[model samples]
Each structure stands twice: as structure tokens, then as C-alpha cells.
Target chain A: MSKEFFTIGALLYKDYDLIDVNATLRLLGSLKDNFNIITITQTGEHVKSYTPQVANYINYNFENCPDFDILFIPGGIGTKYELENPVFLDFIKERAPRVKYVLTVCTGSGLVAKTGLLDGKKATTNKQFWDWMTSNGPNVLWVKKARWVVDGKFYTSSGVSAGMDMALGFISDVFGREAADEIAITAEYEWHDNPHWDPFAERIFGKNI
Target chain B: MSKEFFTIGALLYKDYDLIDVNATLRLLGSLKDNFNIITITQTGEHVKSYTPQVANYINYNFENCPDFDILFIPGGIGTKYELENPVFLDFIKERAPRVKYVLTVCTGSGLVAKTGLLDGKKATTNKQFWDWMTSNGPNVLWVKKARWVVDGKFYTSSGVSAGMDMALGFISDVFGREAADEIAITAEYEWHDNPHWDPFAERIFGKNI
Candidate 1:
């Protein structure tokens, strides 16, 4: 609300889930006047996603990255590898508190959790990797039955396509419900508007899908 | 079935729908042993999506593109510009018939329609642009009620997110219903199981979604 347009710094790494970044960010980027999006890779000029192997063009390296209003963290098979990375962890530690909102998709919570940023906050991640989710944030309250969890400025989604739904929630919070619905309708997406009901979680916990 | 792996030659132009290509193909690409996906652009080393400005690394250009088992076509604001390009049209005309299956997403039907291969085939495209769909292929049996149409070897989806549903249908056709369902579950996607009932189409035609 303070800025004319929110600047989003999307931190991506090798083997990141393709849909997690694109589908979610695509919706946020739809509101051109309200958001400015950019991609940042730790040290590489480019990064390749885990499966189907799509290459992404990196906007800025970590060293020269611009300050952003929102920090967009995407989960991947790759984030686990960067857990102990001093520069990566340092970057999150430094920037997470300054940003107005921190939106994470899937294993992105894993990264932020490792930084001890979500120590007492509620979060969630890819239900398929429930063990990975639990292991990442020992001190954090991890909700297993939600499509996404929002505790203060941090929002974490379940997995893959759930990111898009979470992004819509963000849009609804920043923009309006009408704006979110219009986007979901335009995308032709069957938006799971409810953040609490997660079929993946239910199925994982031996309940009916 | 003859080959060890099904090679997918994805034809993408500038400003091609990001989610249409990534979301649909990402699932296909998930079955690593069954699929071999590659990007084919129209004379560019890299192509950018319409919004969120994601850049795609092109594998091969039109002149020296490789032949594959399936031909993937994605629609965007950019496809309309290539309607008359001989090489693009020729690529479709040549490969479409030779391939086992030809899958098109959103406005991709518009590009393929111009090539005249879909003249007598039952096709569907993005319902948002009804005029563009109708104008591109007058002779084609354009279905306004379906999310996706499968006529012979040609498969055309209604619009952006509909592509993911159509791709799952393709998986079910090639693999099995169980295989498609598993992928949908893994992606954590809210799969629209029934393609015959397209709410987007109905909504566009003045019905409730």
C-alpha cells in the first residue's frame, strides 16, 4: 500500500519445480500496474527445472540483486541442497524481515524454515514429501491439512499447482476477491479458493480424497 | 509404442501461453521413460511468455528441428502473427500427419486451423476469443461446448488451463486412466475429470460457471 507498485524478487535455484514458479508468478504478474516481477538465481546466469527440464533466464545474480517489496521463494528438489549455503541462507536472513510479504511455494518453506524465520509461525509444504516438510522446520508449526497456511506476512503453499491457488489468495488480499475470481476465471482454473481443505493432506493421512 | 520413448516436439512461438505449455507438458515430461520433450521455436534461441515475462530456452529452430512422436502446439497472443508464415504452416502440415498425436492448446487451434489440416476435424479453442476461433477455421466442426475435442489423431483444448486437462486425457489414452489420475494427484492439481462438460465454454456463452 505504501509503494505505487510492489517489486517481487523471485529466488530460484536449479531443479526448481517449473509449475510452482511459473503458474503462481504468472497470476501475480497479470496485474501489470500493481506488480513488477524479476528472477534471481544464487550464482548462475540460468537455471533448469527438475522435470521436463525447462531453462529459465535469470534476471540478477544474488550479489547485485535489487531490493524488493515481496520475496517470492519457490520450492524444488534443489532447495535442500542449498540449506547450508552461507550466502543463500544469509540472503534470506537479511531480506525476509525487510519485505512486506514473503510468499513461498512448496519446498520454499523448507528454505525459509532452515533460516529459522518461520520458527514459531504456521506453514505447510508439498504433502507428498511430508517427511521432508516435517524435517525442515522442527520449531515451526507445520499444518498438514491445509492447501496453504498464512501466519502473518509469511504464506506457504502445499505443492506444485497449489502455488497458483495461494497466489490468487495473495492477489485477493492485495487486490480484491473480485480480482482473484476474475483471474481464476480467466485462467480457466478450478481454483480451490479454500485454503484449509486439502485433499492431498487427507489422502496422505489415510483419509478419503 | 514402436519406439523406446515417445519423443515430444513442442512447437512454441513468441509470447506462447506459459501455463499452457509448462503445466500440460510438465506432467507429460514427468513420465521420463515414456516421454522425451523438446522445445521448437520459430527462429529464436529464446522466447518470452506474454506476462510475468518468463524466458524459454529454445532447443531447435524451424529449419533444423527434429521429428518426434507427438507434436505439441501452444497458443498465445503471438500465434496469430504466424498464421501466414509458410515455414510454420509447413512444419505443422508436414509433422501433424506423420506424428502419432497432435496436441494443441488454447489459441493453438487458430494456428493449426490456418494450415487446413483441421478443416474437417472436430476442434475446440479458447472460448474467450470466439471470433478468432471461428474465423481461423470455417470448415472445421468447432465445438463450443467441449473443454477439449479429440477427432481422429487431432486433440484441441478449449483454453489456457484446459490444456492441462486435455494432456491428462492424452495420458489416459496412451497409458491408462490410473496413470492419468496418479499424475493429477502428484501435481496436486484439481483435475476436471469430465472434459465433456466445459464450464468456461458455458460461462463464455452466458451461463453460470
Candidate 2:
């Protein structure tokens, strides 16, 4: 492994979407030779997901976390509750700005939106809960028809499976399109290459915003 | 939930493919009202994935396991080692015959193929490792171009992300298209309705087998 490999810190909390978290990890972990991945939680304890699946232990807590080049956050039914958590918001506020990439999946955008970093930026969230998600960051220009939105360093994706698409895009941005396409082929994933070709957003919002 | 709700026992082992496992869990879990999901391992301990993510704890071990309506087996790099373990093979042999549905994702088809359940039946596996996967169950007619295959009670998907597509197909088979389509709509997933339209298989093996 190279000494300069990128580090990605994934946020973990109770009720975090298991699919969003795992899919992103699987994609990034496949590039393990180039990335050092760590799972971080509020307290570094075992967290229970909405599926009721328990994740054994997190790698770090806010107080002892290392600097990361990327921050990955996943959204779930728990985001509705985590939004009110000052510790969670504080952690995001502190770490997001320092990371080269701030990636969010599903309603995870809602939590990231609370950090104020998304203010005045273009972003998107899980379309199934669009109205509620949009309300979180009123100042942000939310793209209604995007598999994912990339503005500066922030990458926000729509819904659960869409996270995989966003991660592929992120890989393309970081490693080049050929690398991303190669990874997609190895995983046999039909990469939704265009960020704006989201049918879910079209179905939910009536028009692609 | 109904008294007769189907129970899906998902096999969890060290280095299991987290994406394949979690994607299926998320889709079926969304239908939790109609299913009871449980995670099982060899010794019922917390299992670490190839990505080094920790699953808190499994529900049952081989000795005290419950009869399942469906058995979900996810594949990973660990499978290369697990295929040689007699205990793992015996466990699958004991549980698979009694289950109403047997679901295998990615190289998981390789593991299920070892059970001999797929012998004389048509199935598919991860296309990137096609030659190696095909060698596992030579007598089984392997489909080269398939998002998923359904041979009676068995459902085998092409690769990692393809598992999500196969699970949707399984849902459609068991709960009508309306139910499956509704779930797909909620997840904002473009369910590849036709299993035969697998471009990966076409690209790799030439023509749909």
C-alpha cells in the first residue's frame, strides 16, 4: 500500500441505513489499495440499524478520530432523530469542512444539511422523502432529478441504491473514468453514468428540478 | 405481521460480501411486515466482512437453528476458502432442502452450487470470475447472460449489485408484480424487469445463454 492512500471516515449511528452504509463501504473497500476506510460513531459502540441489524463496533469516536480525506454519511429513519442531536451536528460541522469530499446517501443529506456546509450549494436527497429533506437546508438549491449532485467537494445522492451510483461517480472523479468503469465491470454493476438521469426524482417531483 | 409470515435466514460468515448481504436485507426488510429476517453464522458470533465491517451478532448456529422459508447466501473472497470447509458444506446441505426458497448472490452461487442443489438446474454467477465460478458446479447448466435465474425454488443472481435485481424478481414471484413494482417505486429503483437483458453477460460471454 502507498503511504499517501486516501482515508475515508464513514459516520455510523443508530438507525443508519444499512444498505447505504454497506454499499458505499463495499465500493470503496474494493479500492482498498488506494483507500484506508474507517467506521466512526458518536461513541464507538455497537449501533443498531433500522433493519434491527447491529453493527459490532465502530473504529473511532469524535474525540479520538483521525483526519480523513473523505467523509461518508448515510441516511435512514434515524436521521429524523439524529437531526436534533447536537453532538452529531457538531461532529459533522467539525469534520466536513476539512475533508476533500463530503459524501451523503439517502436522507443522510438531511443530516449533512444541518451542518450548514451545504448552504448555497447544489445537492439532493432521497426522493421518497423529498419534501421533508428539502426543508432541512432551505438555502441549498436541491436538484430534483439527479442520481447524485456534485458541487465542489460535496456529493449527495438520491435514495438507497443510488448511493452505489454516486460512489461510482466519486471513483470516476478521483481515479478517472477508466478506473471507475473497470470497477463497475468487475462488480458487474450497470453504472448510471449520468448524474442527471434519475427517474425516481422525476417520478416523485413530477419534473426534474 | 401475519402468523404465517415467511422467515428468511441469512447466512453470515467471516468475509461475506457485505453489499450482496445488505442489499438483499434492505429490500426484504422493507417488506418486514410480510417477513421475519434473521442472521445466522457457524457459531452465532459477530462476523467480520472482507471489508472489515463487523456484524454485531448472528441469531443462530447450526445446532439450534430454526426452519426457514428462505435461505440467503451471500458470496465474497472468503468463499474461496469456505468452499473447502466440510462444516460449511454440511450446514448448507442440511438447511437448503427444507427451505421453500434458496437465494444465492454473486459468488454465493458458487457456494450453493457446491451443495449439488444446482446440479441439473440452470443458474448464473459473477461474470468477472466466470471461468472459476463455472468450474464449481460443472453439471449445472450455467447461464452466461442473466441478471438472475429461477429454477423451481432456487434463485441465483449474476453478481454483487445484481443481487438487488434478483431479490426484486423473487418478490415479484412471491408477492405479485404490483407488490414488487410498488417496492421498486418506493426505493426509486429501475427494476430490470427482464432477466434476459443482462448486458454484462452479453459483454462477457457473448449472447444471452
TM-scores of the models, in the order given:
0.94, 0.93
Tens digit per residue, CA lDDT, model 2, A132-151:
98898999999888899999
Alpha carbon deviation, residue A20, candidate 2 (Å): 1.0
Which pairs clash in model 2? A75-A108
Q: What Cα-based lDDT does every candidate model obtain?
A: 0.84, 0.83
Lowest lDDT sum, 10 consecutive residues, model 2 chain B, at B50-59
True contacts kept of each: 0.62, 0.59
How far does residue B131 in candidate 2 sit from its true spot (Å)?
2.6
Q: Which stretches of candidate 2 lie over 4 Å from their true place?
A: A1-4, A52-57, B1-4, B52-57
C-alpha RMSD values across all candidates:
2.4, 2.3
Minimum summed lDDT over a 10-residue window in model 1 chain A is located at A1-10
Best-performing candidate as measured by TM-score: 1
DockQ of 1: 0.65
Please provide, for model 2 over B6-104, each residue's C-alpha lDDT reduced to its tens digit, 9 standing for 90 to 100: 788888778887788887777776776677777888888767787744344477887788888889999888888778988988898988999988999
